[model samples]
Target: MAKTDKQIAQEVLDAVGGRDNIASIAHCATRLRIMVHDKEKVNQTEVEDIEKVKGAFYNSGQYQIIFGTGTVNKIYDAITGLGVEGKSNEEVKSEGKKQGNAFQRAIRIFGDVFVPIIPVLVATGLFMGLRGVLMNEQILAWMGMTPKDISPNFILFTQVLTDTAFAFLPALVAWSAFKVFGGSPILGIVLGLMLVNPALPNAYAVGNGSAEALKFFGFIPVVGYQGSVLPAFFVGLIGAKFEKALRKRIPDAIDLIVTPFVTLLVMITLGLFAIGPVFHSLETVILTGTKWVLDLPYGIAGLLIGFFQQIIVVTGVHHIFNFMEIQLLEEFKYNEFNPIISAAMTAQGAATVAVGLKTRNKKLKALALPSAFSAFLGITEPAIFGVNLRYFKPFVCGLIGGAVGGFLASLFHLKASGMAITVLPGTLLFIKDIGQLPIYLLVLAVSFAVGFILTWFFGYSDKMAEELKRAK
Candidate 1:
C-alpha cells in the first residue's frame, strides 16, 4: 500500500530533525521552504535520499527541499505538526530591523508574493495552449457542423478553464499576501472578494458605474481590486499589522469580536484612502518602466530574457513573466517579441534532454528523461530542479546557448504569430516577413548542440559515478 501523505510528511520531518530544528516553514508547488536554526541539522543528503524528495538547495538562508506534485502541502502539515517552534514575536520584531531599504523590501515582497502560485499557473497555461490545438483544428467544430459550427459548450468550457485563474488572480494574490504578512488568510480572502465584487461600484470605473461602489465613509473613491496586485498586497500587510496590534491590546474577554471589528474598520479606511492609490501609482510606474526597457536595444532584451528566464524558473518567479505575456497578448492581440521566451523554454528542455542522454548515473538518468520530456512540453520545474541545475555546467551552457538563440532571433526579427510556446515544433508560425526561418533554425540548433556537448563533456563526475554504482 502507498504511504499516506501525512505518513510521508512525518517521515520527511523526522529525517530533517523534527519540528524543534525548524525556524520557519513555507511551501510552493513542489518544494517545502524550511528555515532551520542550523542548516547542518537538516540532513539534506539524507532527505534527498528519500523516495519522495526530489532535490535540495540552500539559498538565502532557506533549506528548500523539492518534492513532486501534491506533496508540498502534506510535507508542510507534517513539518508544522513536528512541534517546531517558529520564531518568537520578539525575534520577528528584531528581524524586521535587518531588512533592507524600501526598494529592496519591495523586490523581496514581489518575489515572495508571486513565486508560490507558479505551478498552478504553468499547469493552467499548458492547458490553455492545448485547448487552442483542440479548438483551432476544427476538432470540436467538426463534431457539430451546423450553421453555428463551433460548439458553444466546448467554447464555454475552454474559456472558463483558461481564464478563471487570470480573472480571479487578485484573490489568489490576497491569499498569498495574507500568509506572507502572517494574517488570517480566510479574512484576507473575504476582503479581497469584497474588493473584486462585480456588483459593487468600482471607483476606477470612469463614468457612473455603480451606486454601491466601494467608498470610504461614502465619499472616498476605490477601484475594482480584482486582478490587481499592489492594492491587495498593501491591504494584507496592514491587516497583518492590525491583527498583531489587536492581539496585544484586547483582553481575553470578547477579544475576538472586538479585535476583528477594530482591525476591519482601520484596514478598510487605510485601504481605500492610502494603500489603493499608492499601489495604483506603483503599478502604473512599473508598467511604464517595463515598456521603456523592452523598447531598448533588441540584443539587451534578448540577453535579459535568455539569462533571467531560467533563473526565474528556478526561483519560481517565471510566472511574473507569464503575467506580462498575458497582458501583452491581450493588449497587442499577438506577441511579436516572445520568441526569446520560446528560445529560453527550448534551452531548458534541451539541457535536460542532454543530461538524460549523457549522465552515467542510472537513477539520475531516470530522473532526467521524464523531466526533459516535461520541459519540452513546457513544464520546466521538474527539469530545472531535477536535472540541469544539478549539473552546474549544463545550466550555464544552456543559458549561454539560450542567449545566443535569443540574439539570433532578435537579429532576424523573428516573431511569434501567436502567444503560445507550442509553436516551437511548428516553425512555420515563427517565420517572419523577413525570411528568418534559417536563422531561427540555426539558433535553435546551436542551443541544442551546445547544451548536449557541454553535458556529455562535463557530466561524468566521480560523485555521479559513485551514485550510479550505488544504484546498481
Candidate 2:
C-alpha cells in the first residue's frame, strides 16, 4: 500500500516535536527546512526512519529533512494543508537570525539567496566544460582534425551555450535577490539590465582599457556593472524597499505607474554612482583574498577546505560556494577549488562504504551502501546525512582522507576546467590536459582508500546504530 503525502506530513510534524517547536518553515529542492524553537525536543532518528525520507541533518541553524526532489513539494503541501504555515525562504531566514552570530547569519542569507539560482549556473558550467572537451587538442587530434578544422557553426553554437549566462549573470542575481528581499522580480531584472546597458562602457572592455567609463553628471565616473553580483543584489534590495515605500504613499489608481518609474529612476542613479563601484571594489577584494589563500604554501589551504568542506555540506550551506565557483570559471576560466572539493566529497562517500561493510546491522548497511554510491557519483548529501554524519567517527575519517587527497591535488597543481561537477563526471574537465587524468584518479583513490580503511577499523559501532535501529 502506498502511503499518502498527508500521512508522511503528519509523521514529519510529529517527529520534529509538533507545531510548538517550529518557529518557521520552508522547503528547498530536497529538504524540509525547519527552524525550531527547541532542537532537543525533536526525534531525529524517528524522522530518518520515514520511508520517503532520504536523510536528515542540522545545518546553519535549520533542521533539514531530505525527501529528495519532486517528492518534497508534495510533502510540503501536505504539511501546509495540516494548518502549519509555510514561510518563504527569506521569511524563515529572518526567524533564524537569533540562532547564530551576525557573520553566520550573513553567510546563511548568502546561501538562501543563491541556492535557488545554482541549477542555471550548473547547466552553464557543464556546457562550458563540454565545450572545453570538444576543443581539447587530444580530442581534436584524435579525430584527425586541427583547431581550424572545426565548423564555424558548431563553434558559434558552443559559444552561445557557454557564454550567454555569464554575460547576463548580474541580471539573474538581481532578479533572485529581489525575490528574496520581497521586491518585484521583473523590476529588479530591469535594474540589472540597466547596469549592463549597452550605452555604458562594458565592464570587461573597460578592464582591458579598450573602453572608457562615462562621467555621470560630468563629475562621477560610471561604468557598466556586468558580472558584478554585489551591486545588483544591493540595488535590487533597495529598489524593492523603495517601491514598497512608494506604494504606501501613492493613490491606488496611480500607484503602479508612479512606483516603478520612481524606483527605477532613483535606483539607476544609485546603482551607477554609489552602489556599483563600491560593491564592485568589495567583490574584487573578496576574490583577491580567496586567491591569496589558495596561493598559500604547500596546499595548506586545500588541506583546510578539503577536510571541512563536507562539514559545510552537512549544514546545507555549501551552495554559497556555487557563486564563488561560477565567478572563478567566468573570470579565471578554470576552477582551482574543484579538485580539492571533489577529493573531500569522494572521501565522504568512501567512509560511508566502509561503515556499510563494517556494520552488522542490515538496515544501516542498506542505507550506507546506496548513499556511498550516490556520493561516488558526485552527490554527497545522501552519504553525509544518511550515513557518515550518523556515525561521527566515519565523518572524521573522511575528513582526514580528504586532507591527504587535497594536499596532493594542490601540490601537483591540478585544477578542473569546469566548476559544478566532480568525481566521474568531473573527469570531463581534465580532457584538455588528459595526462592529469591519472593524477586526478589517484587523488580519488587515495581519499577513498584512507577513508574506507579508517572507518572499517574504527568508525561504526552498536552505539551509533542504536538510534538508527529505532528509525528503522
- Alpha carbon lDDT of each predicted model: 0.63, 0.83
Candidate 1 structure quality by residue, lDDT tens digits, 1-472? 8676677777777777877776667776677766666656777556766666766775434566777568776766665665654443335423432344554445556656666765555455555555655555354456654435567897888788766665566667677787877887876776667666776555335324434445666776666664566777778778887887788888989887887777777876677677876886686676666656565675777766766777866653344664455444433333434667667766777777777766676667777777767765556666776666765666777787677767766656565444445325535344322245566667677666665666567643546656753764
lDDT of 2 by residue, 256-356 (tens): 88888998999988999999988888988888887887788898988988898888876556766776776777677678788999899999989999888
TM-score of each: 0.61, 0.85
Give stretches of model 1 more than 4 Å off: 1-56, 63-112, 115-168, 197-221, 295-300, 312-342, 359-371, 377-391, 405-450, 453-472
Candidate 2, superposed: residue stretches over 4 Å from native: 1-35, 43-55, 65-99, 217-219, 463-472
For model 2, the run of ten residues with the poorest summed lDDT: 90-99
TM-score of 2: 0.85
Best by lDDT: 2
